[model samples]
Target: MSRQMCERPDCGRGPIDEQGFCDVCDRPPLPAPPRPVPRDGAAVRDGAAEPERTVRAGARVGVAHVRPDPWYGLGLVDADQAPDVPVISSDPVAEAHRFCPDPSCRQPVGRGHGGGPGRTAGFCPHCGTRFDFDRPDGLTIAGRYDVARVVGSGAYGAAYLAHDRNLATQVVLKALHRSVAKTARHERDVLVGLRHDSIVRILGYEPEGPHLVLEYVPGEPLSARDGDRLETLLAHGVRVLQALDYLHARGLLHCDVKPLNIIRFREEGPAGALDRVRLIDFGAVRSHTKDTGPVVAYTRAYAPPETDPEHLRPTPGFDLFGLGMTLREVCRSRWTDPATPGVDSLRLLLDRATDPERPWWRFVSARQFAEQLSGVIRQVVAAAPTCRQVTRPSALFGSMPEPLHGGLGAARPLAHWVAARADESGLLDILAPFSSPEPGDVAAALPAPLSDPDDPGVTGPAGGALAESRLALRRRDAVSAAERLTAAALPDWHWLSDWYRGLVALADGRPERAAEVLNQVRRALPGELIPPLALGLCAELCGDGEVARAHYRMVFDTTPALGAGGFGLARVLLLAGERAKAVEVAEQLAEEFRYEREARVAAVRLRVVVLPGRARPAPTGEDVDRARAALPGLDVDEAAAASLRAEIQYAEFLRTRDRLKLSDAVRALGPHAATEREYVALVDLANRLRPPLGRGRQGRRGRTGRSRFGAASGRLSS
Candidate 1:
């Protein structure tokens, strides 16, 4: 018999030498049949079985009995012994499990119970991680510390007061929220290099799973205390200034320095210890190296005027201004007080501190201010300007005047001495001669008015007449000054002379011409605040509310604490029916001057007027009580008070009615229907309350109608 080679490609055994059989590829030789069906009995022809009813060994019989089965022909004993094969098809469940690749998907496949896909048995459809059906007992950090309490939350992350079992200490763990984990890590790396006593310490850092741990300082914020004594407050201020100076030296600006960020530590050792003050909250700290970026920190009252929308660069000077304001707060014990002196007043007081001609007031600068305070206290409160003056005795005390004494008093002798020196030069020289001089005495010594005042060219006159006229012009006579400048032929005095000329025109009520000149000057000197303020007043007088608003907005926007100036701008906006914008300005002013009654009243009125009806469904009795409490002892103008009362009543009525309707709609239809119906009602109410259309006297009717509607709407909305 011929032998065959192995058919399997991976098999290496060759066919048997003589039989041509490969055990690896060929079927094993079947046991020899008891008797090979006799070829004669089978009558095999061409390797086929004969057509006959035969019952032979290894021969398969069928109902027809005409053909043999393939397996039977292949030497199988019977066809019934053949192996069964399974059919293959696609499975949707398996495909869905593999479809999603995100690991953090909430709806995982096979975890169908809670935000999961049911198709896959144990896999996530959204994020293909295996489903964890059992809820975690609690989230762990650093494989040790467990979350205990949320200390605080901010844009970067949430701070937690967590207890460490290993160290047996309570530390604040500031972990970055998922949104800013990487950024927090980067910030941590940057801040790790900074070391300062005032700065909150970064005990250690663990950048694991978007979390960071920081040492927590336990104390009260400086802002929490009220009615702090000036000496004590000043001492605390010095410490903060030292920290700020250190920060600035290191090329960093602690942009946010409000009272809230200052931490006050209490020690039992001594009553006047200086180390009690500490500055914290470095989240808003910025490196001064960057050229441009949005202001990262803003507290309405504490932020400087330079922080307006238009101002871009943050200068060291800006920080100085904030420090100045903070120091002012410490000294004054209030953010604002109409009774308190203005910046000019404070400056004048400081200037007069040493001059014998003027009465002695309080210390003007921080160091001098600190000297009045105790030593330990002084060390902490002295900031930059004051800190520099600390070591200099002359800077601290040289300017102060000797205390007057005796029953007769030093008034007369001082007056005589001052009179003897009256011949000196300048206003100060003339005024210096009088010790506690009466207003009449100073007026009596003045040079007489010029006889030929109409002559613009004359610089000198007899009997000091020209000097007196010049003084008068400086003190008053804006129009006269303008006329003189207009008539003058001098070339060198154009700009300065023109400025006076513009002032005169404005004072004369010719705002159109004044505006023309002032605008020119403003273009030339953008830093000047007076010209812009004058221009705004001019626009207001000319009945150009929009232009006036724009100018006043610029001024108030730049210098937030300009008192009545800010309120004036807000008034223009309010009259223009720009309630929202007006409210924003008013709120800013109110916060900037929290103690100012007028500012607070204006802000409250604007808020009530502009509040959206939907935002407040119904005003409660408590709301009315609070509003009334804010207005205690305030004697507002009759018109303003009436208008405010009307608005409040209308708001209350509108709110109550709408709330009832909303409740019914919600109960009957559904929450969705109630929302839509409420919106429709509010729109209808707004339309009815809208002011009339037009300008000038014709617009007055519309204005009144709108005001009335607003008043009515407010009551209903409340």
Candidate 2:
């Protein structure tokens, strides 16, 4: 009931589709306003003009169309002509801005549903529903927030753009209707305590006036934004999930999530092209742990299908559905053009996240949603023409570690078992989500294959052989994957085939061959992004850090959303002795792009080790400890950690019984201690601390015991 019904007289189109596109024109549906009453005993069509435009939030949209013709295709306006209405002001919300509550009877009753601006307060002449936004305009009830302008009105309350006398900045004053005032206080309590970039901050609240003040963001509602690109739309989607995750973590839910409640950073995306999405309107917010019954404040377009009165106590999955719906509409605005690529991948993500029946299995929570979207964004960015100049860090990578890819990397992948080990999700799925992470291997790490093959069908130019190669790689048979690709019929598919072949060659320890194959792919598909990434791999393996840095930068510069590209660039920067740039790139990868864990470790290394900009002696005990501390998560340089532990123990022994602690020192050194130079240092320290053999004393209590076990650190430093 949130949208007015299309008045084609015979057509069954709702005013807005799930994507906020008009069913008739594919344009964004106009805001619904009140319809003028019919005259002469004839049923007049409600609105005959501007049917696809949005009216004021509570204004009744006239629906007078009399069986209009059906049209299909993308709906769009001039890029420069989209309306930019900054929401919030002191003046009462315009009569044209308010819509009737009736879903079927959308008739305007305010000052000028027909001629002049309607009165500030009145009953709908056509539907007889009373509406008001006049109360909070002049009253300074809280004494600090001067309710200067009425920006908007809704079922819960009237919102006024106000001035904070103390802070001298703009803020929104929500003067809630007494019926929902308690909910307003709950919302204030929820928001005032939290601070997140993607969520609006609650400044203060006044109990007497039953109103709350929230920070004013200078942007238009997403409903007003049109023609924005799909990347920006996806960014907004990630931010929304992050906000929801933050809320769910605190046991609260913003049950009434919709496009109208989101603020686009500006008319268009930020210069960096990252969507700085801020969620507002927390009226239906309440504790997920506490059952509050069916909530009245929800928009049908983005509301989950499970809002049954008995089951209205919101769940994290429920809110996740709402967010999915909201993102769909935002994304659909730019997907009108059939020529636009990446829509299929994005729609698949949307479909998965909003799967009313089975969302939780794949995206059980916001964190999962963020992670999957991270994969989706990588594809979209790689497919994109170019990335924004600046991009935000990804949240998905926040938990991963700085992958230890050694220079000229330990010949091929260590072993099948080593290649098979993974924590969660695909382990070596660096650049192959779209190419398809060889499920066979990543899944090998798991007890079995993905229980529910969420793997998508190939919609890109690449086809079956590409998938086969990926499977082969996961099976640790890069030679066969390479051989099969070499003989495969890749006519126009040459670039795509070679791109994968280059990866296979690199996996097989043929960096020179990988470089040759990638070079061919580059010329064949100069605009193709995969070549840059593949070439970077070859370059790094060839010991040309500068060339690797350049290629990786090319990939990341063209698409910041691709984690592999950004991660590669961060790694290259670190290797190239560009500490500052490496730290910046690492932060961006971790924070905005979802490469969370790896970036954190890389940043730490840049500070404690890599950034010193000069070769130093072996890592001191403290230095090794710093490195050890940075990689706290599973799947890391275990050898480094082992050596550091041995050193710590040996140092402790130096300060205590040298010979007595020898056995424990040996335990700490781990195996392969003699192989790594760092571990060997610990052996020398242990040897120096050993009780000197007494040539004169025929039986130095432990001298004979120590001789049989000098250093005794063999098994500790693997």
Candidate 3:
């Protein structure tokens, strides 16, 4: 057989492969020379009767499918101010004070002997250890980085700000101390494989100097600035958590996550100014698989108490604990506002992230920590009265179908129209406005906890059992729910199991017991809003208004997207005689498109709702007018709309004694009555409220009596 030649005429060395490429040249066969085109520009057919080519190579085509990232900044802060990049330190060589690199003896090595300038390189007098404080000022490192100055130094390494000759940008050159010089390769291995926006970028490492080249973040350490929003601080925490989660996913731990390691800066982009944070300093990063042994390096205050320097086995939790402490310290500088909306949730979040008692119970993953931290940010943003944000669905709970309106969102009862009383003046007194919904109703209405997909229970019999328990509770079969949960044989520490127990207690009308059980779940999942929301409902059912208010406010203020939480909060606020505040909450709830109609109607009713025994004042004329004005645009059914009209008219009658208007409004509701009794009651209410006829000259002398709606007979107007 003849050997196939290379595609190129001059490079015919070996046989061409099936891919039409010569093995020697490693080059694909060149494209066939362009075919000659006919003058008519129609067809170019080969003698073999080849098919016509329809799809040409490199043809301009249809729209390309591009999937852009959906995430932007968290929007918790107004990051519109562009911050100036901090200037790099000058005179770095002279500024880098001489010190022994030996871990055992880090004493001063090159200090002046007789009030003169210190030497740059020398041996430590204490341990006879060689030390080099030589500044790389003008010298190029690894033939690429032009040394600038020493920015930071520690026992393990010293960071130098250097300009990259190749990249034409500044970078950090971290040179490890001689004692831990080998760690540079370990850090480079961890960093080179990672790519996340929040994490620092790694360049090539120089083994000779044992230096790790990193992206230089031109900003200060993560901190609270003057006029900074609390959410801003928490947002930084969330970003750091994201980086940590990315690292943990790859079986790596950033064992030294602290404020100093996270750099916060401002970037100006095409869209606008943006506040950004980057996690840096991977010198202490280590593999999770080989975490056992003496800790190489870590800040004492940020590390967990259990982390002994002599024998430390670090987990992902080690980084999370450090982040928790970092945020705690930074936030302390401006954490004076106890009344801030998400402050309690923030405390709960940090507590869970750094739980001292149960080391295993602390945040199990960075993703888990981010979920709760993000929830807290929502709460903080939602606390503003004028702020209306899009509702974010809870990650840990299913949607709550119930509005839990507590009667404010519903129409007046049939009894309110039929059982009304009229005075001698032909004025009808309707039933007092509805109070709170039954606690049993609120309990059943609360959102159900969603089981974590990654949980071991999800793939076990307990998962199926938990679902069955939820179904049983929904059917009001408390007994079945309890039995299924008991049969599941879940571990005692399983939060989902306790969650079901709480639901069962609620189903059984034992809110006090439910509260106790749910509180345990809260401790287990402290960052979750679902637990607090469930607890709020339980407290409300138990009539512990104070506790309910706290819980409801926490969840609602965090994110009004949870309609149940908002409605529940509004209900208790009204019950507590905070009529104005309750109305405000309902109005805010109306801002959410999903709950707009219900929330709007609730706001109208709350303004006129009469807590008969409470100290709340009766609805004023302005309140009645407002309710009437809001009724026309309300997207409710005929019956609901008529009922709302009648409610407003009744309030108007109380304010201005407009009997004619009240009677007409009441009569308008007749067609919507579900039963004959209800219709008749509505008629009676209208008739009783209707004005009597004027008395004739001869009829004035005749005897008069009260109308049928009146308690007793009285003189008639006719």
Candidate 4:
């Protein structure tokens, strides 16, 4: 009889299989409950960590049933578009114990080797080693730590949950592979000296044995992080980059930096980005300047193209590449992200990292990489405004802006535009589909609606998405509309969901949220101008004059006659003390919309105004005469035309001493203004100021020249 090798991290000893099951826990696999979206009248989804479906009597679903504990529903979003936290699978990480005792001859021997259920007890077919997975508990080590549970076992080593008596804390003790353990001591010695906020702290070194104690971060790996978002991951990337920068400054490189080695602490916020991150499992740290050994450990998914052990020169560049790979996965988390505007810039960073041989310039240093990732992070934060969101200076755009009460008072227009360009472009035309107000109308005015087709969700069934959402919006049940779109969201067409959510937010009177959602959609699909238009409208409604002005100007500059853009820009300009520019805008609009009634009225009204904060300089003699000449063919009622002309003359009289010739003024005045209210006011004032009215039609009044006070009040009463 030969003893088989048991390779389970916790059960490292082999025992003879008995009673058809291993001595260790051998219960059947727990079925993962299906996560189905609740239908129109179906019961709501359970809010358990691993929620099981509720069963009705005689229901076809005959699996194990469990009622949701009321306590579980705490803080659940409770709406149809509730945040979906993924359930972790219960499947064991490692294969069943069936190999030989000798680690080298780890061959299968049990009956279940292929498919059929095998006798738990077996001898290795190759080396005749008894394959037993049963091992005892309460194992102690080096008279200090007690192994309480098995954490994980991998190609590199085994991790165990243990209690450290000396420190009075729960710690992780890694029992490395015998071969690697022989060399891990030197690595551990150097790791003890390394200290950083983001790097997992090494508690103590068990110098005489294979195990070492490490601070057990109470969190899951990046892959298992609950409710992850692009912003959240980008935050993690920033922290990791900081750690990497610190290590590089000390001349060390993390040869392995993948999602598996990243542990996100539970204390961190999910969305707002004020997060705590820990980089763990430094099994492959080396001196970038001096360490010239073969690559020790690396996951191929994140390792650089040049990581072949035969030529692997571990450098800061290698670790930077690893971080790039890690962040790429982070940005594209399991939670679906329709390729957002930031995706492209992030991809460039990734391409540089995973394959640096092509970039010509050696891949960027960690600090530079952090700067790039910080940009992506800021855009993400700006795109999604959260209650607790931190306002960080954007590396992509610039620094903090000067505070202002109103107006386009701060921020560089061009820099702001370029920074937000990718995100705002695709959303302007987003509402075009809703114009028809019915699902039966058309998909869009154009066949292939200009959008980023390269985005993940655009490839799915596309025709009815916008139409269905639009019709739902027409029903005025914005939440229902949002839910329908969210339910219909496929991985490839996720932007459609965001589109309707934005519309819902806008319709429901949540401009800030609507702006946030639309901005995200803009970033995700940066090929069109719809988002910018929508963003401008949102900013306008939210009273963010600067942002609205910049966005509106962008649209008007590109498409001068896009009615919304022109109107929005004019309003923003009028508020910003740009009276002349506002008049010029109206004039430009009048030219573009020649013969249009609304446009003509707008030009006349906008040409003369005195609002609270904005006091336009009095009209010049030339402007007064020009208005008088252009009044007749202004395309408005005779009364309105005459009123406009007289108003201009009144303004000129008030502001300039330039004398007006009554004869020339009468000649230039449109024929329609004879009985206009403004003309009446103008004539009455001129008569009173004339050299003693001689009982003509104007002799009814005995008023001399009206004082400035009387004149100002008279104008106000009119």
Which candidate leads the pack in TM-score?
3
Query: For each candidate, what TM-score against the reference?
Result: 0.33, 0.41, 0.75, 0.43
lDDT of the structure predicted as candidate 4: 0.50
Backbone clashes under 3 angstroms, per model:
37, 67, 2, 24
Task: Please tell me which model should have the higher TM-score, number 3 or number 4.
Answer: 3
RMSD (CA, Å), candidate 2 to true, equals 23.5
Give the TM-score (vs. native) of candidate 1: 0.33
627-712 in candidate 4: lDDT tens per residue?
56656666665445544554454445445422232212322232333334434444333333333234223434443333323333
Model 3 lDDT tens row, 3-73: 55655676676665432334565343344445544432222547332211211211111110111111212
Ranking of predictions according to lDDT: 3, 2, 4, 1
Candidate 2 regions with alpha-carbon error over 4 angstroms: 1-139, 223-227, 266-275, 292-296, 307-313, 337-340, 359-362, 387-718
The Cα local distance difference test for each model comes to 0.41, 0.51, 0.69, 0.50
Model 4 lDDT, residue 680, Cα: 40
Best by lDDT: 3
**How far is 269's C-alpha from truth in model 3 (Å)?**
4.1
Return model 1's CA RMSD, one decimal.
47.1
Q: By summed lDDT, which 10 consecutive residues of candidate 3 come out lowest?
A: 58-67
RMSD of each predicted structure: 47.1, 23.5, 16.1, 26.6
Question: Regarding lDDT, does 1 or 4 come out ahead?
Answer: 4
TM-score of 3: 0.75
